[model samples]
Target: MQENKNEKPFIPTLGITIGDMNGIGPEVIIKSVMNPKIFDLVNLVVYGHGKVLSHYKNLLGVDKFSFNQTNNAGQIRYNRLNVINCVEDIEVNPGEETKEAGALALAAIQKATEDLKEGKIDAIVTAPINKNNIQSDDFKFPGHTEYFTEAFGAHESLMFLCGERIRIGVATGHISIAQIKDRLNADVIRKKLELMLKSLKKDFNIGKPKIAVLGLNPHAGEDGLLGNEEIEIIQPVINEFKEKGELVFGPYPADGFFGNSSQSKFDGILAMYHDQGLIPFKTLAFEEGVNFTAGLSAVRTSPDHGTAYNIAGKGIANEQSMRSAIYMAKDVLLARRENTH
Candidate 1:
């Protein structure tokens, strides 16, 4: 589709993937789009089966909303919900893990990602997917962060979690705890810090972003008493960047950083591993957190939580995180465009 310059201001179209059908993906997607105001902000194209969405609509007792089925992005109507059906004859059994559910989830992600790459969609907001069941020959990445990093051919990507007051990014993610120590190095640390700094400037429109780096061990290695990673690895990188006039600080102990409210002093925080960052992030912003993959050629965001299998068809899933993911994707896209122009 070609851009029409004479029309009203261009609104980017966001493609949403239906995560594992047996999970809460469809429920949250339906609940999120029910708000008419969301339609005004961006055009939405849902890549999933129409029947699955209809099932959730009926189950949730939401009768007022309807979807317009279309196979092409150019045919999407900005004023109504648009769906591009990617699966059929699928059974949706809530709280159950099945091959069919995983296959359906993979199909939606592949299709939506293709559209995102082709510029048919401006950005993508994915619902949650179960990492175990959603594995396939075609979908072999550990999680969305790894999947998108390869999909967009990005040299590297940062798994950033953002909320109202806190922003945290992990240096290493979706890996075993034992592997974290081996993974901590000066080069990896430098790249993560660079990604976080650039993202804070371009994606979030923050100027001169101040970043805090957390240590790998207790009391920041207790000055080499607990571990030497802080002294041998982390501090050297921080010092290198600091001398270059970047607003970077720390190698602070993770416990005292969050306990003393030191996180409030920086624009972003970089943790050495997954649990070190997410444990405190979810504690503070579980409901409204957004998972954004920074350094990708195209923008992608997902809710900070996973597929809630236990609450899958209960119609009680909170849609706040899903909604925040959509809004964050839009904000990042807009910020990138503004920075480019």
Candidate 2:
């Protein structure tokens, strides 16, 4: 049920998938939820094995924390971390990639996704999973964005890397840099812009969002001296939006656009490819960034960083990104609710 605007705020039941138990997924998750204040925001439910979490809880030496162990979401107790067992007696080998860990990750994802579909949970905050290990017959997508996009039957989705100061959406994702030119076209760029526009309005409450589009080549193709893509492909689309009276601009040179911090002038940014946007975003806010999949029918968010295999079980993994993801999921869900009402 939607919360009434005049009523007290409703606490959302947020689901978390313990991604790749061997990595720092479990550790960061535990640390994020350890604070009692989180319970005041939402009902937290984790989809993973109790035994694996117990191992990490002991490894991290968290003695004063407690949680409810169950296979049912309906039995989740408020004010305590609740874990729904998705796998049975899984072994955890930190800093190592194994088929067992992959299976556990997939199981939790499948279970939480099912719950989300059935309205058993409001939204999901996923921890980092090793993309290489989490491949199987049931899961063949490139990453979580693609997986959830397909699962929810969205024609396309945007890999929106969001931080406090800026938000960026990629025109193409999880593809080779060589293939960007071949895959990128007017239709692709237009779709991404549409998704960004709608998400900024509905998910973020930006009624008239100003967006900046980044060029694919050096110096934004230097007026066609560097590349023709900016002239032939990108600018035409930007002009199309402008002709329609939309607040979209650029084919700005990727280097100078971000290098000069021009991102602050717009509400959202559209980068031509992955590394072009992420390298700068991570550099700016790696610890607090949230990777949100926009345009999906349901709300899903994950930490901007991946599984830190080198730091797995080291007791030093930063939980701020994980915490931010959980909070972002709740915020987006609330935004969606408010827009609907």
Candidate 3:
């Protein structure tokens, strides 16, 4: 589907949460919004402390731009960078994770999430957060996907990583390798596949998306030689979807799938675990991938990277992934609107 430039554009308001203050989240976000073209794409409301952003702006030598402060989401200034301070009197220490940093990160996310649910913001683009540090009684999910699933009351959500060419959805995310086998089940696989299919059609505007499902074991269990997940759980779901006339295929070996460039043949891919899909995805599209949460009522996206503490305040953190996340969120929001209409 093609967007008509002649039509009146629907500019969305995007809420950005600062993930870990000690990480490269603020640095990358500063670099991303510095481009005037980004302001043209969407009205951005940053949910973090102004002091934290100010420190990064100076540390990174980004002096020409300034964030317009606002106390309310409705007061966001279009065509400019706006900030809503979620914390006050906070000292930012780059390249070090602390309880204060995690607490502030959670505060920012909480505020942004509330605004997103209230329809004050059309979409949300989050920065990287430390899974270990950013833990509290209020925030107890494994990662953002599970948090959003319960927050938005969605039955299921998919951790979809997308770039210009490849899009992958992981069935299980942020879990230990030892727990993967027990977690692999037909119900889980089927729900993930359904979510991926729906997101491809509605959010990506793909009418008939062909999805490739990867096997859990080596050589897809070598026909139950290595494991029975392929035959018992994975293949059954694929067959069920196929019999229903869906363009789904494979319990293909994970190694050959990306090694042989088979990913280019399909519109999307569904992997049984996190590393199986992400390792190949990052290798291929790390610099420009966006982590999109599919099957949520509200759109949310983040850079396909984590807090680069080593490069936090070095002023060298690549902003490409963050920029891609912002643009992807806008595109997905637009596509969803078009789909609904």
Point to the candidate with the largest lDDT: 2
- Cα-based TM-score, every candidate: 0.97, 0.97, 0.97
lDDT of 1 by residue, 188-224 (tens): 9999999999999999999999999999999999999
Taking all chains together, the TM-score of candidate 3 against the true structure is: 0.97
- What candidate 1 gets wrong by more than 4 Å, as runs, is 1-7
33-53 in candidate 2: lDDT tens per residue? 888999999999999888888
Cα lDDT of all candidates, in order? Answer: 0.92, 0.93, 0.92
Task: Give the C-alpha miss distance for residue 148 in model 3, angstroms.
Answer: 1.1
Clashing pairs in 2: none
The clash numbers for all candidates, in the given order, read: 0, 0, 0
Better of 2 and 3 by lDDT: 2
lDDT of 3 by residue, 10-65 (tens): 99999999899989999989999887888777999889888888999889877777
Candidate 1 versus the native: TM-score? 0.97
